[model samples]
Target: MSQNGLRFTLDVDGLTPAATAVARFTLYQNLSTPFLLTVDIASDRSGLTAVSFLEKNATLTLWQGNTPLRYLHGIITGMETGENNHWQMNYSLTISPPLWRCGLRQNFRIFQQQDIRAISTTLLTENGVTDWVPSFYEAHPPREFCVQYGETDLAFLTRLWAEEGIFFFDWFHPTGPDQKLVLCDDVAGVSTLGSLPFNPNTREVSTECISELHYRAQVRPSSVENQDYTFKTPGWPGYFSHHATNLNGQRTQYEIFDYPGRFKDEQHGQDFARYLAEGFRHDAETAACASNSPKLWPGKRFTLTGHPSLTLNREWQVTGSVLKGEQPQAQHGHRGEGTTLSNRLDVIPADRTWRSSPLP
Candidate 1:
């Protein structure tokens, strides 16, 4: 009759401590995208009668026994109050990472002699983000010139990262109560979450197991080819292309071609072409699953076992997840065992190379 390990706590900055609990929550986390956490709160006091008095940021924490499962700290982008009856009032808030603030403003700026990493760092730091790490397996040469072109900071960063096969995810700080953004250009940068078992019996499995799963394979473009023009090499045609070798003869004749590859040299063009090709092949072989795991998120790898198919009983990395949890409405509240958690996860094989799709 107790949910001792399934308690969710929310603390708003500058808001006096009162009776507040997460009645329900939906958290969306994906690669190369900012995380969004929307929580329905039950509170005893309506001290935040008006949005004007609400704090700018808050910390949402989930606990399992004596250990904290996750600590999501973000800016309070939105708030809503509803159904104020008696002592308990219901409200909802939309929380997003500090990086989300970049999307609020547009700018026209030029970055000279800076690489993608440098430009990203400058923008992130300007937006008060100091806890970011970049993990690149290869080198990125400084671009002679780059223009923001009336785009928001988030859009600009997204374009640059997509072109360079870079992606980002947030990870909880080991020794702190916050999360740090990690940008990685290689799959090696992703951390592993050990392993979990797949149990089809949702009625009799632990909270950390996958309840249902599906494997997907589709025929996509087998190759990507693109051509770009450089003023320095006016007469020379700048063409580069790459083909996928992991398609296993599934419509290998299919090709993807494009113009204006946006590279300055042959090597750069080839790299971009490879990244584009990999992007198409990324979802060619994937696994979608439903789980009760609270720790699974993007940029992390986990091994799946107990599956009927031997091929699927391997390590996979999460690319996207939609996590939904609801606290039991029983009188026990925080100590109720009826609390439920469900998550839809999208993952790819651990050995496959992952790349962000190019933005239009």
Candidate 2:
């Protein structure tokens, strides 16, 4: 049986059964998906929440698993908030069996300033609580931050205000000690301030910086083997910028570079970091191909070949595969009689995607 389209719904209710207020809900899906989905919800004229307030839209695909499914596009839209001004989101999806399933999972949190009051209250309150208080004076505007987990390590960065709100700053690899710092002002813009050296013994970066807005510190490993680090910042109106580098010092083979919309001040810096990490994972996997590595399996004769066409043209190819000896077992397996072994050969493909392509 072919899977069908997805259906989503959200509900919001007040702490009191009948107490409700104007609440807005927006749902966004990364364009990286085979399809895009977005939903938005708002109040109605009668002040009564109705199902008609829900909006659903999707991007459909004509191709599904070799065969062109008659109707194979995805959708995006939003539903109304609950009666009591609470937020509830629901999504239902349908697609062909085996190839497509409802594999969607979402992580969301009520974002607020890291201030004592906001953190103490919002982080502690439940969905249907009326005891919630918004401390306007004590509220610190939300900053943007991002985190990335590579093969061998993790990195996080955040953009925040500094110097008593006179300057803006960035903190990267914010572990315990070995963190990188950057400061920016209207005159200087953004510039690298310094980096905290990694300490293997303590597994932390020992560094400290005190600015007017906040005090920051970080910790990280001295070195990482196979991993990637990502950096992202909320874009100004009509522009967004994100950068990622493999901990192994490799550049991402394929990526999309474009500006989204401006980010709201209330948006948490950490959320931006998380989004960059997620986007990098998707782009990297799509551009990655298997390669033979001597580091993974030593002392092996392997001829790494690029894409078939590249090999034919003597042009560098991005694809890689191992060459076996007369006896496959002799090349990468145990020598014992009837014993079979396979050695992992490592071969880093020569980057050539940009060699022949036009620069943007």
Candidate 3:
């Protein structure tokens, strides 16, 4: 294996390479967003004729020690190939989850008396997505009517999820390329990873650890005030507001106000108000870290240790990550050449609940 004890194998349409043959790869992952995996490979011939890989299934398996640590499964959505030299051909491929196809088509549709969960499930099912789980704690009252309105399935679904404060992330399987889509509205649904030490001096540590970390905080509104009108109760305009606790610092009193909050009654208005308030404060505080740990993916929690600031040594949840790996040119044909795994992670306090901001 490589110096970082990381290796990977890429299988495209049942055609597994003898070695990973991967020169470089970048995996972009984030909560509420579909992942994109791009990998460059050195092959013996052009993939265009050897294999009809486009739109075919693909999986990238990451290995640590003798065990598989992570699996990225998706469809080969894009590809480019060219001759690198007389001995080998170079190609690159883009892999994305089946859910990504939802954005490829737009339509107009309507539903009556359905909740967000039920509506979203239907959209996912219609797009041929079957492996998904719901982790919601709040009640989703059925709406009288819902409309897709000439938007892509992803666009419509995103709007619905944002309104209900629900988001999703993928969970990689340990043994195969099968990943699960976990839809969550609460932090309890987030998975956790054991603690890792913060060792700034990368050369001094042998085990997987964070080499660099930084804490950040920004000002955001502490409360949300909203009002809506309904024909059934024309005389009474629905009004509701929600506030965050202990955000009494500088500029923290700033308030957000909205008219016609898109709800019919006071109960729904209150819920939307809370969702808006939480959405505003979602990124008020965050942490940025770089690590060699392959387990630090979005929608997962981890604890930090050995930090100069004691307050930084606490539980945090990853909100997004950029994972990069590369192998030296000399080891291209090896079964498992070493891959230098470096990752940049965006995280927030584990105690804070995550909410997707309303899309404009």
Candidate 4:
């Protein structure tokens, strides 16, 4: 009959060492027209245990209003672990006497959830110009590390890296003979890495030798709203300071430094050290608001400070539905009740410091 669009963002952080996965299912319906059912299903996985070279499985179903239209079954494989892993499926069916006025529904199930230590957000650049990278560290050492960047999804990778105190190498396409490598240090020192001996036509690092040897420094994005904001460390080496704020000019989040190395699980010493170094003091008043709602205001502003590290893989999605009257439809062309599922996964090495500021 009719269809409506829906947008959703599901963020799951894994605290275990085993691999963990999540799924999302969607159903659609239109009450104004005759019976026409449509269904879409998707899945994703994230966490430390999700290796890049592994196969995974997913299940999906669909329903019209209340009656079953068709049943659909399928599997998803070749899932990689990191900041983002995803799968999707879609199908439609026609009921024997199309019913008018219907609705849709979806469900998701995780087959496993162990060894999935630490899951966070995946960031991407807005203009598709740059990429995010990640460095690994041990789960137990001390010294907090993190990253900060612009408002683009690309910033999420930096945030994750800042929290984890990891590093990432990003190879960019050489523009001209005057190609310059500008290394911006936490201090005010800016050094040039010089021009490439050979033209690197693509934005990829041609050789590990050349790329690894290039000038390396923590990369930070310039602030648009506050030009006075600096990307320098206060008293720490290889670290930077940053501030986060909300629309009301309230400082909701902030970061001090990023320590390089793994954490040591000695008598909660690592946790205490992290709490002292990479932690941010949330505004009690604002934090109370976040605890009360599932939705965030569109213009809310967040601050971050750190160096460039890894990038995350992310996607944009919207949901829709098809249905007849109040009956349910089936998925695909099968005669069973309809269902849907979606999942995502991220795997960080155990030897890394990934920490996040308090939410305000």
Measured against the true structure, the TM-scores of the candidates, in listed sequence, are 0.93, 0.18, 0.93, 0.19
Q: What number of backbone clashes does candidate 3 have, counting pairs of residues 3 or more apart or in separate chains?
A: 1
- Local distance difference test, per candidate? 0.81, 0.23, 0.81, 0.23
Alpha-carbon deviation at 346 in model 2, angstroms: 6.3
| Candidate 4 least-lDDT 10 residues | 287-296
Model 1 alpha-carbon drift over 4 Å, by segment: 1-4, 16-19, 50-55, 174-176, 329-337
Per-residue CA lDDT of candidate 1, range 1-360, in tens?
123467677778766435456788899999989999998887777666656324377887777766777788888888888776576777788889888988877999999888888899899989888888998996677777788999998999889888888889998864447778988988899999787888877776544787777998888889999998888779978888898977865877898897978777777788889989988788888889888777788988999988888888999999999988787462223455557677899999998768887687
In candidate 1, position 157 carries an lDDT of 89
lDDT of 4: 0.23
- For residue 115, model 4's alpha carbon misses the true position, in angstroms, by 23
Model 2 C-alpha RMSD to native: 24.0
Ranking 2 against 3 by TM-score, winner: 3
| Per-residue C-alpha lDDT of model 2 across residues 1-360, encoded as one tens digit per residue | 111221222223222211211121121111101112222322222244334322222222122234432222222233333322233222222211110112221223333334333432332232122222221222245324221222111001111122012111112221221221122212222222232121222212222211011111222111111212224433433233334433234444444432222233323233333234332332232221222111111111122222233332211111122211111121122243321111112222223111101111
Residue 200, model 2, lDDT? 22
User: 150-268 in candidate 3: lDDT tens per residue?
Assistant: 99999999888888888889987657677888889888889888789898877667677877788988888889999988788789868899988646374656899988787776667
RMSD of each: 2.5, 24.0, 2.6, 22.5
Task: Using TM-score, rank the candidates from best to worst.
Answer: 3, 1, 4, 2
